[model samples]
Target: MNDYNYVVIGSGPSVFRFLPGMQGSKQRILVVEANDFGGICPNAGCEPKIFFEGASKISLLSQKLTGRGMANPAKIN
Candidate 1:
């Protein structure tokens, strides 16, 4: 049987940041996550929302500047 000194639950952003420091240490660590790692922010949540919002804003701005002396306006793909 394997014994761990530290058991981390949920691989969120904070966990990601915290785990690196634990590396190369003698302590045994185990990470338990039931779903895709990286938590909500990077997995179908805040990050995607922010990215799409930025894209939307840029697309709108491009449309507005299309005929106002700007060439090759930004495109979201």
Candidate 2:
């Protein structure tokens, strides 16, 4: 059977940071990624959140520029 001294499962920024330390080391290191690298922050959650927030900001800005008056302004109803 194949043997390795270290196996890192997730492919996130932390993994990238840790990779340099493993270089030139005697221990065999293996990185196992089941999906896209860079993890959920870049591939799913955080990035999408940022994108949606930016879109909302742009929509608000456009409404303000056109003097449309807050499109769904908080009504406290």
Candidate 3:
């Protein structure tokens, strides 16, 4: 059996922040994660929501300006 001085379960950023302080301590460390190794806020949570909202807003703006910007929709350049 192997012994670990430090065992962290999640891959979240909070746990990773401790890595710098643990350097050269000569202690056995283990990190076990069942999900993706690392995650970014913009990749998973708030950013996607913001992206979808932006798309929805663009759609709404397009509908509102359907014939306002150009005289002929078929002759767009």
Return the TM-score for each candidate structure. Answer: 0.54, 0.49, 0.50
Number of the top-ranking candidate, with lDDT as the measure: 1
For candidate 1, give the lDDT.
0.85
lDDT of 1 by residue, 1-77 (tens): 89999899998888888888887998888889898888877786786778899999988898889879778688887
Report per-prediction Cα RMSD to one decimal.
7.6, 7.6, 10.5
Candidate 2 local lDDT, residue 36: 92
Candidate order by TM-score, decreasing, is 1, 3, 2
lDDT (10s digit) by residue, model 2, range 3-75:
8988999888788898888778888877888899788887876866687778788766766666455545332
User: Candidate 3, which segments miss by more than 4 Å at Cα?
Assistant: 40-43, 46-77
Index of the highest-TM-score prediction: 1
Q: What TM-score does structure 3 among the candidates reach?
A: 0.50
Q: What lDDT would each prediction earn against the true structure?
A: 0.85, 0.75, 0.71
Residues forming the 10-long window of minimal summed lDDT in candidate 2: 68-77
Q: Candidate 3: lDDT over CA atoms?
A: 0.71
